[model samples]
Target: MTTYAIAHLHQTELCAEIVEYLEKIDGTLAPFGGRFIIHGGRVEQLEGKFRGNLIVIEFDDRERARTWYRSPAYQAILPLRTRHASGDVFFIDQVAQPHRATDILEGIRVPTAGVAP
Candidate 1:
């Protein structure tokens, strides 16, 4: 199944060390098939607390997401992110299509929310 990972970073505060730590994580993520669809930017909140950055990453599978997160490189820089900000990193496997239950969901990219279709 295709897995999607959303790494949310709510930076209640930031410091020099935290910026450096995110850099380290960036380097580690490069090797894996990781790409950030969302990063820190200006936006008007439509609902509840919108405090910080939201990072959405697309991975091949749950295993791949887990591997990137648990790998030594990420582990090494994990502390930096923790020290700098309040965040959450999670992966969710999208339900496969009825006709393609045996296949992966990566083939079908779900439309993002807040779109006028």
Candidate 2:
């Protein structure tokens, strides 16, 4: 399954630190099969409220996404981000295929045979 690193920054300060973070983040991702899908693009609020920038990175799986975030390479430069902005960071695994609401509901209707059925 694919995973995404979703970063929603609420406050940001443009400075040399951000510059360095941008410059080096790609290099850190290359080794872990991670790539930027969205990098500070213009965000249009359709329904609710949102602030600052949204960065989405795709990785091979949840483990790789976690590893990339915790790796020494990324950890070393994390302070730069923390120093400039603050927001939510998390990983979400993507569904392998599109499914209807009923299909998803059926998936949770019964427990597994061995576990709790």
Candidate 3:
């Protein structure tokens, strides 16, 4: 299954170290078949609080995602991110096919013959 690395970054210090980190991150991820799907684009918050940048990365599988994060190459540059920004990162497995609301609630015995509320 495909895996994803999602991050909600906050409070960036944007320095030379961060620049170095940015320059090297792609090289580090390439070995694990990791690539950025989203990196620093305009964000519109629909709910709750959001700050700083948002990043999403895709990998071949859960193990690949975990391996990339825990690899020595990434470890070497982790401090740059920690020093420059604070955020949350998570790995999630993708569902084979995303469900519609009714499809997701099928277990609840909601009739799918018509629109469900």
Candidate numbers, best lDDT first, in rank order: 2, 3, 1
Top-TM-score structure, candidate number: 2
Q: Quote each prediction's TM-score.
A: 0.69, 0.85, 0.82
Q: What's the true lDDT of residue 17 in model 3?
A: 94
Off by over 4 Å in 2: 107-117
User: Cα miss at 99, model 2 (Å)?
Assistant: 1.7
RMSD score of candidate 3 (Å):
4.2
Candidate 2 local Cα displacement, residue 51, angstroms = 1.2
**Residue lDDT tens for model 3, 21-111:** 9999999999999999999899888999888898999999999999999999999998988888888889988776765656656567655
Which lDDT tens digits does candidate 2 get at residues 7-66? 999999999999999899999999999998998887878998888888999998989998
Q: Whose lDDT is higher: candidate 1's or candidate 2's?
A: 2
Clashes of 2: 0
Query: Least lDDT summed over 10 consecutive residues: which range in candidate 1?
Result: 97-106
Off by over 4 Å in 3: 102-117
* Least accurate 10 contiguous residues by lDDT in model 2: 99-108
